[model samples]
Target: MSLLTDLKHDEQFNASEKAVAQYIITNKEEVLNLSIQALSELTYTSPSTVVRLCRKIGLKGFKDFKIKWSAELQKEYNAISNVDPDFPFTDDDSYGEIQKKILELFTDSLNQTSQLLSPDKLERAVELLLQADKIGVFAYGDTYLPALNFQNKLMKIDRSVHMAALPGENRHLATNFRQGDCAIVISYSGESKNNYYITQLLKQNGATIIVITGNPSSHIASLGDLILPVAESESQSVKLSTFSSQTAIDYVLNTLYGCLFVSNYDKNQSKRIASETLFLDERF
Candidate 1:
């Protein structure tokens, strides 16, 4: 992601940092040669505030931010993605063409999601999963399906995971979770009411939070310890369907499941074998 892109998406910025970010984004060309003091002065914030913003976005300081920002501006970046996440197909398309578009849409969605879900975040999520006493999966609507799939995988692996997505029961689940427990909350917008409330409960209860979302600039994302962002291409309110978002969620959950399995490779393999054997008698 570009420096501006990070500034726009990441919700971790404070009010002062946000002011500096707005200035930098609105005056991109001006920032090319701008110093910390000058940029801060333009934004009416301090140089320290500018440096803090720089650090929040993973840069060491103003110089480091400048180095990365300059390189990104100089580099030729690609168009958003090969396929449009929202409108991958049209009314004029034949079934054959639609099939091709569907395939490509999923391909593109997974690619974008993989890029957004950085390796360090993935590693941290898995680390938390390994450390947690129990795991709870929370989501609403379309996002819940991927959470269920992940829950099933965790259960099969002998990991104690619960689907807390049931209506009216998330609060109960949240309260029940212990300090060492983990909550995997999935929401594309990152601002659902139930998710926000339940996440708040989880937070107070001292459970670790791992948020899977598309929008990082959201209240839920701020409450999370680890945020695994999905493809940011799909519009929150407008879309042909949940195709791209669903695909992205599934990819991220499956990646997590696969990573967890690989973390304890031999033990998980044996567990899978044992699980298969238990179901072997059901020929139907």
Candidate 2:
């Protein structure tokens, strides 16, 4: 489990212990440089509370917690330093410079996403998708393109998948969802009100929910039966468009499609070849 997930879900932690855990999560970089006393002072808790929090989370002590936290932080820092996803190229940048920066941004996004991805969660998602009677993809705004891409890929493999980028169509689809179905929602912020409503309706119909988001702590992520977290570049300026988020989403969808393709390789391949032949015959 992620440290944030553990902190959020563990019922054994008291208020003070949770407070220390939250402090560590929010100020991980600073916590790496602080002593137990310093951390306790910052969190307004006792040193004993800090130690207890660490132990509860399966860390040996404050030092162990700091070491693990620091490692994760370092990985994030390296990814961010490699690229600024929002403004990867500027007007002053030459064509070569722009190409190099875009390549760096894509590489960094994939690398960081690989680091953050949980193998168990991925396997679980695959299992659900394979067994689902129908797959419904939901996304809005910038994420809709990737959602449509995913739907197209799944359709080629003879899977029952549905997606609607528009709100009215999406609402109709969500209402029609049944038990044993699965809904995959793509949202970078993981806080879209429309998504939340659609997810609720799906849940009411007993469909399994898979959420792909850059924000792990968002409410939408908490509702997911399976959560796929993507790495996001930390930039000081607000982003007007999503670059890394879309890249990460595409990577995840492609990976999932690959898994599905391999599961019934002979059948899927034959179907794909037949489909290609038919299309070619018509065109020719």
Candidate 3:
């Protein structure tokens, strides 16, 4: 039996579900990355109680809960932070004030994205990316900036990645892709026709699709093999560029890169050595 399943029948721990849930919601940030003993201590419960709590909630174990809890807490924080200020806390015309406001919006967006993530979704996306033969990335308008940055990061890790940065070239470039590949589409609203088309084409070619979008139920969601929800602009009064969406994309890209590094550390060593040698002339 799973460790959590074994602990479910314990009477002493049966009534603590509400308390455990509250503890998780309150101390999510601190204990989100914590071990079982650390979480138990933080929650003012015994390790066995923590284990039992996992069973109650239907998680495999404490580690599984950590991923889901951390994501939910981050999402909650993001949704709160992105909403526009009610009044002029700082004047919008002031450069310093504008900078601070932008920071708040992006930070909130990143937080919300994390909270909405499920452990199963994150794990499944990671598995797809790691196993894919090739990866294609695309974004339109503002989303393209982060897509370009993501492509660069993956290239540094020696991943075979392609991106569409030129006009009228996205479709032609995308058409060359085949099965066993992956397509990562980034859109703030997940409403872009171009992105939706790309996703549909990729799927038709037997490629797995990963969509990062602010709208979970948008048309592109249907095309996605995995849906990653970023934060959309929360201000109804002002037209703000999609800063938070890009920030969330940054976090996901970094997390995926770290996972890939760990999975291919030995192979990467040879690649890194060859890269350093090839660039030796530029170094001098």
Candidate 4:
């Protein structure tokens, strides 16, 4: 029987032990590389209890148990592998197939966000974004690419905007924010410790926050003044995927820019366009 099936019959364990064991089994996909100490803290069980549990399960010790458990989880995940969007797609795929995939991803994402996103939350978010005198964006991994794109887009319209191209471990750029500033944080899982600490620091200083994440329930979401949910599709082979989430973020930025343009309708668009056209010769 699987660990899950075996657990249903193992009523000998106390509630706490049972809980710890279940967490370890259920999270094998996420915790395979974790050491016993890390797993102990994650499962909230003592190291001794962890070892004892492994022996009880007929394993030699914690290390052997974790490896076996991880193998089982991997086998199970492999069976459902096709469900993840990171599956290989040839560059020569028909345009229709690409279009259909994109539509399906975004359509489901929109529906989910529509159901979960409240009108009051959006109003509060927009108000914060509009009121900010400065903006700081921080992201890492695949997420940083989108942050750079957003920074460039924002800078084109607002010269005063500051983009932290790379926020290292210390998040040194976080200190530049002031009371009227806003911090825009992006993370696929919404759980990067560095980003989370930056959010906490910004909030403590009275800065508004905008968080874009694939997992809305993640720790980073709780700190956001505005939460933007991105769609995610994961796989066992490929550890992470960015296609759908990046598309969603780009759409949000475009919408916000449109709103800004409408709000500045009284300003002359021709002058702004001309100011950006300095590279072209007068003959053109």
TM-score (all chains, Cα) for each model: 0.68, 0.68, 0.62, 0.58
lDDT of 3 by residue, 1-284 (tens): 43223343445354555455566554435565678877666667778777667766677777877776656544544444334633323431334335555767666666777787666777788799888888888777767777787778778767878887587677876787788888888776777788778777777778888888778798988888898776655442354444556677777776666667767788877777778788996885
- Whichever of 2 and 3 has more TM-score, that candidate is 2
Shift in Å, residue 190, candidate 3? 1.1
| Best-fitting candidate, scored by lDDT | 1
| Per-candidate alpha-carbon RMSD to the true structure | 20.1, 18.7, 17.0, 17.7
Q: Report lDDT per candidate.
A: 0.84, 0.81, 0.69, 0.66
For every model shown, the clashing-pair count is 0, 0, 8, 0
lDDT of 1 by residue, 111-228 (tens): 8888888889889999999999888888888887878888888889888788765578777888888799999999899989888998999999899999998898899999999899
Q: Name the 10 consecutive residues with the lowest summed lDDT in model 4.
A: 80-89
Model 1: lDDT of residue 257: 92
Over 4 Å off, model 2: 1-81, 234-237
Return the lDDT, model 3, position 263.
74
Which candidate do you rate higher for lDDT, 1 or 2? 1
Question: What order do candidates take by lDDT, descending?
Answer: 1, 2, 3, 4
lDDT of 4 by residue, 1-284 (tens): 77645555557677656876777555545556788788778877787877777677677877887678767765654443232356323453334344555566666555554555555655666577777897777777666666677666656655355666544643667776768998778776788787888888878888888887777888999988788765554432463355656666665555555555555554636546865776465545
